[model samples]
Target chain A: MVKTQIRFGILGCAKVGRKMCRALELAPNTTLYAIGSRSIETASRFSSENFLPSSVKLYGSYEAVLDDPEVDAVYMPLPASLHLKWAVLAAEKKKHVLLEKPGASNVSELEKILDACESNGVQFMDATMFMHHPRTLKMEEFLDGERFGRLQYVFSSFSYKASPEFLESDIRMKPDLTAQGAVGDLGWYCIRAILWANNYQLPKTVVANRNPSLNKSGVILSCGSSFYWEDGRVANFYCSYLTDITMDITALGSNGSIRLHDFVVPFQENEAQYFQACNSKFINLSTGCEPARSGELVRADLPQEALMVQEFANLVANKADGLKVGKKWADICRKTQVIVDAVYNSIVRGFEPVEIMS
Target chain B: MVKTQIRFGILGCAKVGRKMCRALELAPNTTLYAIGSRSIETASRFSSENFLPSSVKLYGSYEAVLDDPEVDAVYMPLPASLHLKWAVLAAEKKKHVLLEKPGASNVSELEKILDACESNGVQFMDATMFMHHPRTLKMEEFLDGERFGRLQYVFSSFSYKASPEFLESDIRMKPDLTAQGAVGDLGWYCIRAILWANNYQLPKTVVANRNPSLNKSGVILSCGSSFYWEDGRVANFYCSYLTDITMDITALGSNGSIRLHDFVVPFQENEAQYFQACNSKFINLSTGCEPARSGELVRADLPQEALMVQEFANLVANKADGLKVGKKWADICRKTQVIVDAVYNSIVRGFEPVEIMS
Candidate 1:
């Protein structure tokens, strides 16, 4: 029996799509089967610039990619507004959906898309590449250990200074194209991180910080939110399109603390460093080694994004029980969307705390 | 024609006093003149343990040390409850006061102590040694530079896991001794860090996190607060006596970000590291570092506490200009107290936002 390769079709020519195309090529179990754009010239240009294999097919419309019987999966990197339409159609076409995140306009819309994926029995996963990194799994193991004790507080930040040109013309800054703005762009990862730390426990309430900057279109350029759990566990996150690039996650537990400077994306493609300390305290002589520093360096055999594609493809190619939807991932995506909505609601209500309804 | 050395007296045999005694010895313009404990036996034991100079005097009572004409300055490491009484008496007795933090129960009590110090013309300084570190001056220079641009957000945390014995019997856990508890101990450093980042601009509002762990005596063990400025600048601090040692200060400015893992006390006594990024942003290829990375390692010529002793001694020894008080330090101490009070008030009022009066 020959090994089966999941053929993935590319949707749109977004900057992120360029990275996804390379990821598909790098993923051993996935092949770049097709490319789709509004115009064939644009599709051709993307394929050329990305150096796509000549065997890859090109189409002028996303519908053509979904229609191709050879394509087992469609990777959608469209704008947030377009995700609801394209993702549902891809799922309806019985193709696996590897959708870029801010999965939908909101939780309700994401629920609808998830419904389609569930009904169609197609594997669904978000393109949150960092989640697939070995480092993330290692950190989770540490967090689950007794040495770290009970986790109490978490802080995550993801921000980057968008160029003036991007701020002026990028689809992310257009209210109609991406209604959630930076909330959906950067906050998605931050919320996902908080939930991941808590074993995907949703917070009871969320309050946005009061210092969000908005573009002329009333799109968020920068924002933050604080989340509170029933057990007095707290998490806050900051995201921006107007600061130096930063991705941090700091978790404080009863007996230890874990810190990572680069969480959304590792500083390097293959390795990442995180700091953890257990039973830390200052000893005699006013010097502290109780938080004896442990710099954990996690190395990945493949780049995280490639690993993400490979993982998604593995689910799609799992013929033991035929292809089935990754229901937990869809649930996780919906929970993340709910939090994004809660933060947006709080910001809309002038920074008032909003209860998150499960 | 003789360069008059400021004679120092240490009150109480608290663990911190051990460090202060060494600082006084290291300071070029200061000499350990006396040590006062309730019993001469205890004072003599402390002197012997600390390897003090043979010329140092021992006093059985704090009042006797204050009464000694040669004791030009008194380093008060007594409990918070005694600060109001002994600090005022030390000032009234013409001895400069180097008081440990949480100088008093509240701002009102600290105000009285400050008033006495000002009226008596005796120098005053808190033993927040990090403030006197040469690295602090360097950080300030970076904050002042155009490259760092405008400061917008600050996060500070200071925490350490206290031994079980300390939790049960330390003066810090006793309401009658240090009423503010963790808010007075670790939180003092956190608040000072925020103020230092903002150039001492007090926030308009303070809101404590809902989940503060309180001891049986109603003294705080762990707490956090968020402070908001009118111009949308925000700061937050987390402090605990129930977690591993962690001291971090991260300041995000318009053009850059500055972060130090060891802010309250340097990881090493002689040198410390801080990371800063100016004009940072993400570029093409999905990898970051546009702001680039700069790791600044600062070396201290003398320990921070020794510098604090020397600075305080300089003011006290300026007899040619009629020995004057370090008035600015007194004001800083007062402002820190006001913020601490605001956090405590907010926590007490069900986590409601409290306005900082000053």
Candidate 2:
């Protein structure tokens, strides 16, 4: 019997690529098949500095990784502006695409990438690691349970104080490299968290908050926006590169409420916790109340990134088992990009409400 | 030496009045001097049910409590529509006034009450209990410290599920009884929390969210709004009667973040906790982070309500020490009411942004 573990290749030597390299090594059904950079020396140096296994392949150019017959999937962590080109090439080569988020520069670019993957019969997923966390599933259960009732509101914030060096030299500060700045870097996670809490329902309209601060290059350094659904469900998100690192999600429903202070990245690698309260009420003298909250600790056998890798590999192997490629994730990725573009449009139009056509 | 305890007259038998009655009893410088209702039997029954001392006075009309010479201060917990009438009468009688929140139907009515208090030369303070909590002081210390830096963002949500009976018949559900409905009841806290977080600086504009759900009489049952400062500081709040009870305040500054789950009425009467994070950063493999958070417990010698009564009494007694009547609290209350009115106006104008004119 032949072993058929999914083969993974990562593009670029971005800071995030180091984490994905470790995730591919830890994921049970995946292998670290290749690492690619524009320069062979850079890729080799990254491999050696990280002490990666000797059997892993190294390529000088991204196209070499896509052309490698043994690499079953490409984990594209390239900049947001570069996604459309590399992702389409990877898909045309029959490689499943695991892309980083803000998956594309805009909806049109994201649509082109998605269409290429669909045409080539490959699974496509954004590298949103927290989505694969066991705690997220527990939160979803609470949101979907009878005790929780229907969801009404969601609020999320993600921010970190970027170093002076990062502000000066990071690709994220370059408009041609990362179009949305903090909106792409930190706000993507916040927007994804909000959409996930609402079961990926695209909001009818998006309104940018009036207090966006832009950098010298006119890139967003900090910003916020609100999402409105026709059914009265609403969500808001804030992201910044000018504040201390904070990631939070609060979802309120008719009967229950859930909150996590570190939803994007858990405080601990192996465990995550969320607080929930149900049927809360004020009692005796209004000093105390019923439905005292309790935090549920979810233990992860593998870290969230590893689980994300494992989940993507499972989808790839499922296709090998004669199943149809999963379009649900691609559809979510497209919708998220559409909202991101809508928020940008709204901000550019003096914070006017932008109707989400989709 | 002559004893100088401030005397408190509670001018209603409402459920909240019971809590205030206990607070007055517990406050070191205050005594429960009088109880009043439309019927003498009702006042007497309330005193007996609440186990009031036998020496306490009972009155058949609110004006009777105001007329009592021994009642140095009046705690008016009347319905919103009745606040302007009774509070003015109490102020005309030269009694220091401690009034319940949503102190009047709108900003104009609140301004009238403030004017009356100013003309009478008596202290005025709203009975916003949480403001007096020791936890609030501790949180303020953190916010003011170098570690917290300058305020950048604030988010607050206060909600509670209204029972069917309460929705159908409670004063909070009636337009004449509570003109602002959930906005007056729950949103007052949220708006107050945001204003307090910002050092009571009024926002330049207030924009109500588009999805406010209103009762049949056109009172807001659930709503949200955003406040924008001139220097890019932003605050938003969500208040509701249709969601599970959740009181949350998350204030993020340039250097640190502070979060408290039970900001309004804490889960415990004597102790409250807030979490603060400073200089947070991701460490090792981006899996875990540095500067992990720790909760600070603020233990109170007196319950928040009792502290509120104590603080108000101190201001009243200060008048005897040749101090002018404390106008700080009244000013804060007026600003909060102005923002509340602005939110209501924005909603009334089809969710347009209303410029807040001080």
**Which model scores highest in lDDT?**
2
Q: Could you give candidate 2's per-residue lDDT for residues B150-247 as a string of tens digits?
A: 89999999988888898888888888888877777788999999999999999999998889998788878899999999999998899889998889
List candidate 1 stretches off by more than 4 Å: A1-3, A319-326, B1-4, B319-326
Q: List the residue pairs that clash in candidate 2.
A: none
Model 2 DockQ, alpha carbons vs. true complex: 0.84
**Chain A: TM-score in each model:** 0.97, 0.98
Model 2 agreement with the true structure over A135-249: per-residue lDDT tens digits: 9998999999977899999999998888999889898999989888887778888888988988998999899999899989999899999999999998888888888878889
lDDT of 1 by residue, B1-358 (tens): 3246888899999988888887878889889899999999999999899888889999999999999998888999889999999999999998889999987889999999999988888888888889999889999999988877788788888888888999999999899898888998899999999999999999988888777889889999998888888887877778887766778887887788888778877877788788888887555568545645567999987778888999888877774356443478998999999998888888889888898776
Error of 1 at A57 (Å): 2.1
DockQ of 1: 0.57
DockQ of all models, two decimals each: 0.57, 0.84
State the displacement of the C-alpha of residue A63, model 1, in Å, after optimal TM-score superposition.
1.2
Writing each residue's lDDT as its tens digit, candidate 1 over A1-358 gives 3236889999998898877877888889889999999999999999899888899999999999999999999999889999889999999999989889898888888988999988888888988888999999999998998988888888788877788899999999899989999999999999999999998999998978777889988999888888889887888788887766668787888888888778987877778889888887665568445546578999998878999999888887773246443477888888899999999989899988899876
Q: How many clashing pairs does model 2 include? A: 0
Worst 10 residues of 2 chain A by lDDT: A1-10
